[model samples]
Target chain A: MGDRERRVVFVTVGTTCFDALVKAVDSEEVKQALLRKGYTDLLIQMGRGTYVPSKDSGKLNLQVDHFTFSPSIADYIREASLVISHAGSGSIFETLRLGKPLIVVVNEDLMDNHQSELAEELAERNHLFCSRPQTLQETVEAMDLDALQPYMPGEAKPVVALINKFLGFPV
Target chain B: MGLDAFAAACCAIPVLASLLAVRFAYVLCRSGLPPTRPRAAGLRCLIVLGSGGHTAEMMNIITELQKDRFTPRYYVAALTDSMSLQKAQVYEKSLIQGEGEKIIKNAQFMQIYRSREVGQSYITSIATTLLAVLHALWLIIRIRPQVIFCNGPGTCIPLCASAFLLKVLGLGWSSIFYIESIARVKKLSLSGLLLYKLRISDQFFVQWTQLQQKYPRAQYAGRLM
Candidate 1:
């Protein structure tokens, strides 16, 4: 009979198959951690990954939901209190711009692993937390909300100004 | 006497061709060096949107553009990339809703031939690349956009090449602006490399300081994401 606001954690892997991160977050320990942190809902955008979360919905008191893909993940990201995502720049920047606390799980299976460079740089700047699949649990357990600084989204004014200047347009 | 004249003419032809080639190279190198050009009332802006992250970054930059000045925007995306075009359409729709229906009157979407497909062999890729270049040349000639803005993607190479050819021939002046993708924190993409090495872009921007340090010509734009 009582209704309360639902706190959600959104996990997304973009358009790639990252079963490692999906499976890591599906564990009982991670779900229990989310519950302890007062998060009531867990939504996962699995992308092409074949793994379906097997956690029981009734016993844990935490709602677990997932889908293969969506037309727009921004809506889900906006609804989430926290975000766990792959190191894809699109997801990382989107989450950061939305001012959500993010944990980026780098996919080691990717060739060249160029995604790590952006992740590490942002993480070093205290913009987001970076983790590997093996260390995601530890990251989830140890993440402190107070440690993050609000990210300032970049402006296109400089680039636009340069373009206007190059064309001899009035400043 | 006729045979002697013909032989002299043949030698002159090769010399003239070599001289012309040198002049062409000079013009290409000197392109994008002018501080300013004659201002126009309205400009044709050609925007190149690549797959995934490139498209997202470009959209971010485009949102900051002066919509009134850059009239009749042309969005170019790869034929195989459906999502980019869809995103462009959605963006235009939002603009229309906010401003009015007139905002989309001149906006157009163009699909270009992909230069190469994934897992395609190098031998066949060369042929496809040439075909794509020819298609792009035709598009460039028809569009004659005054300014071309592109980020990382193979699709932009042909279009940039065609625009550069026009600049060399003095047929049209399309100032090419190339922005290095943010995903490349340390290095430039292949398209970025060709644009930089060949000096095709009038304004080259890199999002990271390290990349700008490594490539002196590239101006660090401070993370335009």
Candidate 2:
């Protein structure tokens, strides 16, 4: 059997905040910073990543893994050591459930700073590390995985039961 | 002379009376009397509030309002989280772009009762309506909008309350209750019945002229879209 790879960095750039990530990758300095931190490969899922099919182009020196859509996102979440995603409720909640350390980037256009609000809330609760494109490298390097441990590998049954009760169903 | 005819006539009288009363109240409120004149432009700001299919229909009116001189702002208080609020915002942004109007996608958690059981569905509909009314009231107070354009499914209650409050304060504007084309074409539900009470609007915009005739007090603004 092949040795299972641990500490895989899963990068998602298909969220509303894709532009920022794109801008970050386009910068030679950020690309070098990511390589220095040992994130050897970049998985560009969604957004502008899909449009640019050419591999080994632009300032991004790392291997480019692109996916249009995945039927089983949970499988990917389970396999990854660190999950980088847009500040979406679904992505944040799912990553926390899997016990994976999450780094979130907020989408600016969705609303007047809703992503920032969610990011701050999650950060305050010590559940995730959130950083903008400009500070992505610093935030990634300074991540405290221990802080996210309490939220990892939890079942959503309690939340489901709460919703069921609110809906007047027997929980 | 027949017994059936007499019963029909008796029922028609109260319906007609209520309709007239609503019309009279609407006219009294719509007319800018003395001190109310300054609030005329305020009244012109028609704030349409709803979620789902009703919100989609309201978007059509918002489009027309854009073409005309009257400025219309939209408040889309979504009842369900199943659909992305961003999708609704995108639609609103495209529809209201460069018009200097705003679309507020306020999220309200609602438990939709989808069972086919008639009795349970009816009760659930009533409960949901009450919750939406409460939400609408909260939004109305915050926005302080002069006129409320309600496209319903229980979100009208709070909006109506706000309109009522504004009227009392002499900042009273108009409310135009929109009876969506889809509801009339499809089967009627309990929520549709709740809408009958809100037949009173400063102006009621509907697709059909027959509805305007039935409630003679309502002005036929033609097809809103």
| The candidate that achieves the highest TM-score relative to the unseen native structure | 1
Chain B alone, model 2: TM-score?
Answer: 0.55
**Model 2: clashing residue pairs?**
A99-A152, A99-A153, B133-B158
Q: What lDDT tens digits, residue by residue, belong to model 1 across residues B1-225?
A: 999999999999999888779868876767666545568657888999998888988998888887888878999999999899999999988999888879998699999998898769999999998889999999999999888999998899999999888877778888899999888888788899999998989899999898999999998867777
Model 1: residue A128 alpha-carbon error in angstroms: 0.5
- Model 2 Cα shift for residue B78 (angstroms): 10
Q: For residue A77, give model 2's deviation from the true position in Å.
A: 2.4
DockQ of candidate 2 (2 decimals): 0.02
Chain A alone, TM-score for each of the models? 0.90, 0.71
TM-score of 2: 0.41
Q: State the displacement of the C-alpha of residue B202, model 1, in Å, after optimal TM-score superposition.
A: 1.1
